[model samples]
Target: MRFLLIEDNRELALATRDRLTLDGHVVDHAADLATAQDYARTMSYDLVLLDIMLPDGDGRDFLAYLRDIRSDTPVIAVTARSEVSDKVGILDLGADDYISKPFDFAELEARCRAVLRRRAGTSSNTQRIGDVAFNRLGGTLTIENRIIELRNRELRLFELLADNPNVIFSKPKLVDRLFSFDEDVSENAIEVYVGRLRKHLAASNVSISTIRGLGYRLDIG
Candidate 1:
């Protein structure tokens, strides 16, 4: 998953970015409102970690601006404010989740996974597609009670496909989503990853099937 971190504290932002990167998420950092808004307007991020107090203005104002533009991207308010009203107000203003400052990095990561899962329409943290049990929070995949370790790209590809089972994604679309910006990607890259994922799922009920001239389908049934 790709994330945007909007924070003013340089040390905290760098530390958070490093932690999220280590957790297998691509993170972009912004020091203030202007930079954050600039990045948000141009790039497609899966989630945003926002600080309520910015150097320039209130984070709520930024949230309102995002909503005004109709950006439904999930935003998690990570600030020093832990008041019930503050949480309620942000939730009412379309924030996905809230975490107070001086928080545990592990807890923040967990909250991030939870919010992203909700956005992905996953009801539970552990999802079962066919016989495969995927722990999104734990970042592991299990088949028939056995654990299967997937490479980073493979895991990301599988996550995207499994998130929308039965939906046939075209090659170009798959390539765009799976690879990050600035990557030197090839048209065959998506196909190659799909092939590897198919073999990984061969023993289980899950499989990625070719859709003739269309693309590929991560079909469980």
Candidate 2:
């Protein structure tokens, strides 16, 4: 999973980012609302760890902007103990949950898992395409009990396409979702990932099909 942590306290932000990274999530940190906004504009995150007291603006305004823009990505407010009063309004404004300051990092991890499970509408982390099964949480692919080894970027590309199996994603969209702001990725990088994933799925009933000039789709038999 990918996450954006919007926090002003340097120590706390580093701690949180390191912890989430250890747990296999890619995290981007911003110390102020302006920086957070810039990060948000360029990339997509599966979840957001937001601090209500940003240096430049209130976090609620960020929440409202996301809602106004119809971003269904889940937001979890990380607030100080005194900000408990703001929870009701925050939730109403589209926060998935809130974690008070001085929280256990373990608790935050569990909350993230729970909310993401709900978002996926399943307690299970498995997604199937014909006989091939992808364990999204574990980041593993299986077919009839056999495991397939794919490179990290190939796995990410496969996961992105699997997430929206019905939709055709252009190479530009793949570049945005598979790589981050600091990475220099070209459209050719997308093709390489797709080509690799195709070989991995060659024996399976599922296929990653190129739609002429339209880009790619996950075709399930």
Candidate 3:
């Protein structure tokens, strides 16, 4: 999944970005609210990790702005404030969940998954496409109860395709979701990943179909 991390603390932002990247997620970090607002306005993110205190302004204002713009993207507030009133206020301001500072990265990731699951309207993190079973939280793919070994990028690509079956994803859109802003990506990067994924799904009842001039889609029989 693609994530926008709105944080001012360089150390904490780096740590959070690294943690999420290990799970095959693409993360873009903004050091201040201005850059964050620019990112929010331009790109589409699966989730946003927002810090309450910012260098430019309060994160609550940004949350309100997002809601005012009618953006439905799920946001989880990451702040140092642990008071019940603070938590309630953040949620009331449009945060889907709240996590205090000095929190565990595992718990943060779990909360991210939970919020995403809720947004997707599914209680379970596992999604099935034909005989392929994908555990979104665990980042595992299984077919016939056997695990299929996939590299991080491969798994990320498959996750996007599986999550939106039959939906055509353009190459640019795939690149945006699969790679971060700082990554040096090649023009044929998406094609390479798609080719690799197709080979892995060859034995299953699922296929990745090229839409020629359009893009690609996951087709299930």
Candidate 4:
């Protein structure tokens, strides 16, 4: 999944972006209102992590713009205000979820997944690839009741492939989907993660196959 995080707090934004990437999401970060608005208005994203307070304008104002454009993309508001009315007001303005400042990254990830699953109309929390079970809600992968020891990036790659079995994903698309906007990634980097994941799932019925012109796909028997 891909996300746009519009946050002014530099340290917080960096940390949040890093965590989202580690969880297998591509994140684009904008420090202020202008950049955030431009990206939200012009680009397609699975979700937006928007901070209500901004240097150039209020995040709610941007929300109004988003609604005007008729974009159904989910927005999760991040703000310092914890007032119930404040959260309700944002939700009424089309925000999908609200989290106050100083939140745990795990909570943010859960919100993102919840919103995505709702939008996709999927009620299940677990996805199976052959014998490997991916717990999307809990962020764990297990094979035959035993957890697979996969590093962060590799686990993310496997999740992506397993989530969309038999769909060929190009290298560039995989790179964009797997890495943060600020991260330096290449096609070779994608290959590295794919190789690691292939090894991790070697004993399972899941296999990663390379397409002649396309890219890679998850083949489960």
Best by TM-score: 3
Candidate 1 wrongly placed segments (more than 4 Å): 166-192, 210-216
Model 3 local distance difference test score = 0.89
Q: For each candidate, give its TM-score against the true structure.
A: 0.83, 0.83, 0.94, 0.78
What candidate 2 gets wrong by more than 4 Å, as runs, is 18-26, 82-85, 104-106, 149-151
Q: Write the per-residue lDDT of candidate 4 for residues 1-221, one digit (tens) a residue.
A: 77898988899999998898777677899998889877876556778899999988899998888899898889999999989999999999999988888898888877888887777557677766568887775666787778765666676677667656668999988887777666887899988888887777778888899998899998987
lDDT of each: 0.83, 0.82, 0.89, 0.82
Per TM-score, what order, best first? 3, 2, 1, 4
Worst 10 residues of 3 by lDDT: 136-145
TM-score of 3: 0.94
Indicate whether candidate 1 or candidate 4 has the larger lDDT: 1
> How many collisions per candidate?
0, 0, 0, 0
Which candidate number would show the highest lDDT if scored against the true structure? Answer: 3
Cα shift from native, residue 133, model 3 (Å): 1.2
How well does model 4 score by local distance difference test?
Answer: 0.82
Report the Cα lDDT for residue 141, model 4: 70
In model 4, which regions exceed 4 Å deviation?
Answer: 18-26, 41-44, 64-72, 102-106, 116-125, 136-140
